[model samples]
Target: MADNNLWHETLHDHFGQYFAVDNVLYHEKTDHQDLIIFENAAFGRVMALDGVVQTTERDEFIYHEMMTHVPLMAHGQAKHVLIIGGGDGAMLREVSRHRTIETITMVEIDAGVVSFCRQYLPNHNAGAYDDPRFTLVIDDGVNFVNQTTQTFDVIISDCNRPYWSRREPVHLGLLRRLQTLPESRRHFCGPKRGLLSAAG
Candidate 1:
């Protein structure tokens, strides 16, 4: 809730940031999390999940580009890509830019996030959801990482830190699973592969 049109984000007990809301576009308690989309004079539009700012229209490209492009570019010959938990679709939009990628599998736990973002954040996603190469799976990323037998030349873990009580961090779980995979199937994750890891 915004008091006097100011939305305060308490990043920590001692530090935070606030945005002046120009308009409240949408608000809902989704099946999986709390979601809000509001307009800010400076940010243009702001989307927050579970009371934390996720993406803003003004500067989303910086994050989406870096996360999607850096890894794919580094991989050089990446054809298949897996994205774990980028329901907002900004990451999808960026990844779709690579013409060489034949398939993009995105696993998102919350379908509501995809529904809302697709409707409200059109600029961010830019119809990437409708791309023929995209395949969206409404499932937990941890389960996908553990159970899937498919191989990807590049895998992008775009999940937020876990908010559920006592659940393992999403990326950590993926890392653990990756560690047990045979070296032949371990694509581009470790330091030896010249790719940055979330583990460190």
Candidate 2:
């Protein structure tokens, strides 16, 4: 609980949903964005990237599981999984739980987010970084999608919320490029490709 009447709130004006903080645990401005880990009496540990709430320890499982499982399940089977911009590794952790998954490649643009999540918001990652099936690539996700010869059964986007920035547009363009890949092994179906975003 807050010592005083003071409250640190993350207000999502569009959705009219706000998360309140009781205590601040960690706050840092990385090269990319401002990252904050705070304590909430109701939500446990809460993380915010660039002023938008990413996840709360109390409900992180729900978000991560849905982000990972729903897509993998819908795809029928996922052997090679590609994650883009999930520096917290929550999505990777959930993806690695499936033994059927042969390999997991996680591409996070910001190394700082990865290191910070490992150090302070460790609960989100849960040491999934050490999993044998997991591979970490610290580079621009757009570049990876555009240049990599590797293909995947599933792709996940777990980026920070858009704050009137170019990240989301660039990512969307990257997805478009992914959609245009060669028909044979690009997606499950040949000639037509399906695109799904975890934006909502």
Tens digits of per-residue lDDT, candidate 1, 1-200, equal 46799998777558778999999999999998889999998999999888778889999998889898988898787788888888999999999999999999999999999999999999988999999999999999879877777877777888866344366767778877788878776754433443422311
Tens digit per residue, CA lDDT, model 2, 57-110:
888898789888888888766688888888887898899889898998999888
Each candidate: RMSD: 3.1, 3.7
Query: Ten consecutive residues with minimal summed lDDT in candidate 1?
Result: 191-200
Error of 1 at 53 (Å): 0.3
Runs of candidate 1 with Cα error greater than 4 angstroms are 162-168, 182-200
Looking at model 1, the pairs that clash are: none
